[model samples]
Target: MADGKNWRRAGYVGAGAAGLLAGNLALVTGSIVRAAGRTPAAVDDGPDPLLIDPPQLMRSTVAPTGDGTLLHVETSLDLDEHPSDTVLVLVHGWTCSTRFWNPQVNQLAQHWPVIAYDHRGHGLSEMGEKKVSVAMLGQDLEAVLTSTLPAGKRAVLVGHSMGGMAIMSWAAQFGANMADRVAAVVLTSTTARDVVQQQLLTPPTLPRYTEMVKPLVARAFVAAPVPLPSNELTSRLTHYMALGRHARAAHVEFTDELISRGSPRSRAAWGAAMYRLDVAAGLHALSVPTSVVVGSDDLLTPPLHADYMAQVLDHNGVLRDYVTYGGAGHMVPIERSEPYNVLLDDVLKAA
Candidate 1:
């Protein structure tokens, strides 16, 4: 009991410290103290160096949306032996881009062809017209899958955070048709529903405070310079905050990469969708093997959320698997890549 309490307490402390550090850095970097603790070494020292090795094939284009809104899409494909038998399509979470899956892309490419794309408004993808909805994202995925993957062979849908919600919405709307196309499903650091009210590790909604501060967050995100303080600070805070209680320097560094690629608008859009989403009713229709993975230390999408997801699917007579990582948080893919890849590979083989 004491051990569990300590782990949870440490998780919060890690998040708080990281958040405080990033917030301070963003505010202070424009001042003289910029020389205080600023350096690449001060940022990351993990197994692999930071951004030295980018994905093999970095490609992007504006894909046409039926409604005339362009879908900004960035795709990375491995150079060698791209698997045709199985394809994996990765969807990123709110405020994040495909770059977060860098580690997984590097590893998974060895065995299977992997594709990671930015959602419409996030990353290199074109922003949607008025507002981004879960349904819109679902439609985007459907269009991508139709064009990219073969007519007969459907791809595995892997989503993190908001990405997961998009998959859920897709599954709910298309039902058996989507199920036939999906060989497997992976939900990481994501919720079945109620994401806005429950997942964020924030104070109670002060609508007034949100209205007052949103412009600042937006301006801060847009006006920030390259290798900017916001990116650095968030990368650090999210890494520190979400690391497994026993996480090492390498793990933190990997997780940092994911956080750094996150987008402000994507985060906000998905947060709104999470609050309004209700895919719980659709879980029953999914026929593919589903995997739910989360960190034990995750506050935003806790182990309980994964447990609830697994239970709901099981109750509906669906076969699903649930995994919990120690000392990790809302960034399960980066934090637990090896285990995640193994499970994904196993599911692909079975599929």
Candidate 2:
């Protein structure tokens, strides 16, 4: 009887020790995040005139998710202008809306028909059921494509960050139809795997510490009690994580507005999905002609991701071109719009 009682006491002690260790790790991570928050952001001298305005000639439509959710889709047609055979579909990243592609719409809409849409729980879209996953995002893309594009029309698909991931998920589920519907694909600043493991935000020397802190960071991204506001700290963090160091103040502000407007629940839900993201094998199914673009200074989805994607696409005999912007960050679409636009135009024309 005494031995059994001692064993039970030992079990209690072991559980208590584990709880205490976890509590200490959480406290440490909290302190690090707070320290990062206190750092000041560098301000740019002036705003770029080109980025000051939003897109015009946009028509909004709603596409049902078939699961009681409605997505907000914006289509720009050059009916009396330089209309072309190919349609350009733009997908924005996490914490962003269709407005995130305003610059691209402004440049591309005058030539080809352009379609941009907000993900579930973003922008003018209504949030459906609470469950969110990458598969759901893929389904959303499929619905938007089916509802927006005409029959027998093919599209040149462009996606940034999580938007790029959505394209992969879509290809995975609907690869057979992709050859007929998708003319080409452009993946910008995205990865297929090792997102958490290969992140550059945390230092390499502290692997164990980073592993402990990753879950906390993911939680904060989705649903922090006191959410990070549109302040200097938030701006600084956005600039660091998403934009280039040479990014203009106007660009940073533009990016921050879209990010801050995101729904916390949606953000958290999608963030949890990102934690388990692994669509590397799905790349094999993406048999369409493809292009990859990345920023040299991109801390989120660094150049290594671009390299791996290029290699995989090439091995599959589907690579078209791989381009890297020097000193650019994850927000390559906005940071280097002139060249990025030109590159996109070239891809569209080639397709």
Candidate 3:
């Protein structure tokens, strides 16, 4: 009788404790969900970048860059119902290729035609002269769009990092002409003005020593036209920065292969242009509905930078929706693919 009574007492205490714990968890989760709203963290370790499930129409070809250079480009068609009146053209960042957009291609293509191409010297594209500029990249995009999709059809332009700057450059040069055709713009982990000046004005993510190395790398790339050690070195070093953990081994391997494919000329050109890039005018002039996505933990382009962009647009009477994801670093497209695709769809649907 005594043992039975004690057992019942112990069970009651355990149940009470469990209930309290559960209640606390519920409270915290609710707080998080409320604060974060629609944007949620991506919590999965899935297929590696290289092994990204293939899209329905994966086409590859070399297109004219309008510079007399045959630049390589790739496009992925939707596997599901294709929505006309919209095509999503993805522009990748520094040292990254069209494959970087793989995670979102199929998902976004479901609603629209998704096309991405390697910048002149990145991915499968032809190598060009060193000392690249955002203007040059913008020209490449124009050539690709005019030759392949052109401006006649309505399109949504999505760009990340250097790709973002390239699109802005295109807009700056082309202005309302391009804006009329472009229904929306998605800028991720990128900047609108002189990055060097901005970095100096704000909290520095990469060490000052790292900035010092930029000019050196650019010169070496332009002069020698040989792939620099820094490209591979940085790739190996920052492989795990995208997500909190090292991406699946396949992701690392695929990223390595893609970056390795970039020509020294392209790399150097991009580096030089990056140092001098300033698209504040373009960003302010963008009349299309815009979405700016950044990772809360992004060191390269921190949340503050995204905030600045929003402020810029707001002041210009151009309102842009900003989505900041927690626990994600610079490589957002690959690390948090689903969230990106979902948000992009929402933006597209609204457009």
Candidate 4:
């Protein structure tokens, strides 16, 4: 009885200590990133489209996930001027909302009908009772597709980070019916599996421990559940970790704004999902013409991940292209928007 009590006490103490350490680690890493990473480009005085005048989209409608939870889905279509036959369904990564695709949406909406949705816990979406997992992301995506996609019209799915995972998950789960709706796929700065093992967000030594790092420190980093600080230091850190060398000051601030809005509960929930992510089957299941884009210096999901995914996508003659932007980081979609737009143009043309 005494031993059980002592063990329980120790567990409590250990958890508290871990939480404190994770908090401190975040600050330390942020400082390091600010110090060592490239300086942001000059800020233009003009109002940034993302922050000041974000393009107004269609009504915010609710879409039910596979489990019956509602997800916030919005669309932008300029059918009167530039009518396009195909659709673009954009999904964002962990800790981000539909606004993450604002850049692409603004540019592409002029020609293509664009649909973007928030994950269950991000933005205005309702979190279902089920525990969060990569599989659940795929399920949510399916719900969005079923709800918004017009019957008999196919759409191209574009996902970034966890968004990419959702696409892969969908392909794996519903590959047999994929052709019915999915016209093509675009995976940007994402991985198939073993993200913790392959990621460089934390130091190298942390993951070497067979027992601790993968299961503890790295996961703890994502699952910290602490509110994101919106200070200049935190913005710089976010820029360093998520953006590439070419990122501008506005980019950093924009990214920080979106990240800061992420609720603690949602961050913790999705962090765990991403930490233990494995979607190799989904990668293999993708039957549509697909392109994998990676920033050469991405720390979250590095080029190595893109390499493996490109290889998997190539297996069934489905790989249309593989691109590595030289000075970009994890957010290749924003960091290289023009090039990304061109890539989309190619995909839509081919589709």
Q: Rank the candidates by TM-score, best first.
A: 2, 4, 3, 1
Question: What is the Cα-based lDDT of residue 53 in candidate 2?
Answer: 47
Q: What C-alpha lDDT values do all the predictions have? A: 0.65, 0.80, 0.67, 0.80
lDDT of 1 by residue, 1-351 (tens): 999999999999999977765664444333212321231223233575322345466555556665666665544444223546567788887766777777667776666666677777677777766576767877887667655665566678888877887788778777666656788888888877665445433323333324434333333433343341345555445543455544555666555655556555555555555557677755656667788888987756777778888887777666568888786767777667778778778877777
Q: Which model is ahead, 1 or 3, in terms of lDDT?
A: 3
Give the lDDT of residue 262 in candidate 1. 54
Q: Of the pair 2 and 3, which is ahead by lDDT?
A: 2
Clashes of each: 11, 1, 3, 0
RMSD (Cα, Å) of candidate 4? Answer: 4.5
lDDT of 4 by residue, 286-345 (tens): 888899999998988999999999988798899989999998888887777778988997
Global CA lDDT computed for model 4: 0.80
Alpha-carbon shift of residue 148 in model 4 (angstroms): 0.7
How do the predictions measure up, each by TM-score? 0.72, 0.87, 0.73, 0.85
Sort by lDDT, best first: 4, 2, 3, 1
Worst 10 residues of 2 by lDDT: 218-227
Which candidate achieves the best lDDT against the true structure? 4
Worst 10 residues of 3 by lDDT: 197-206
lDDT of 2 by residue, 237-343 (tens): 78776777676788888888778888876777777777778877667778889999999988889999999999999999999999999978898998888899998
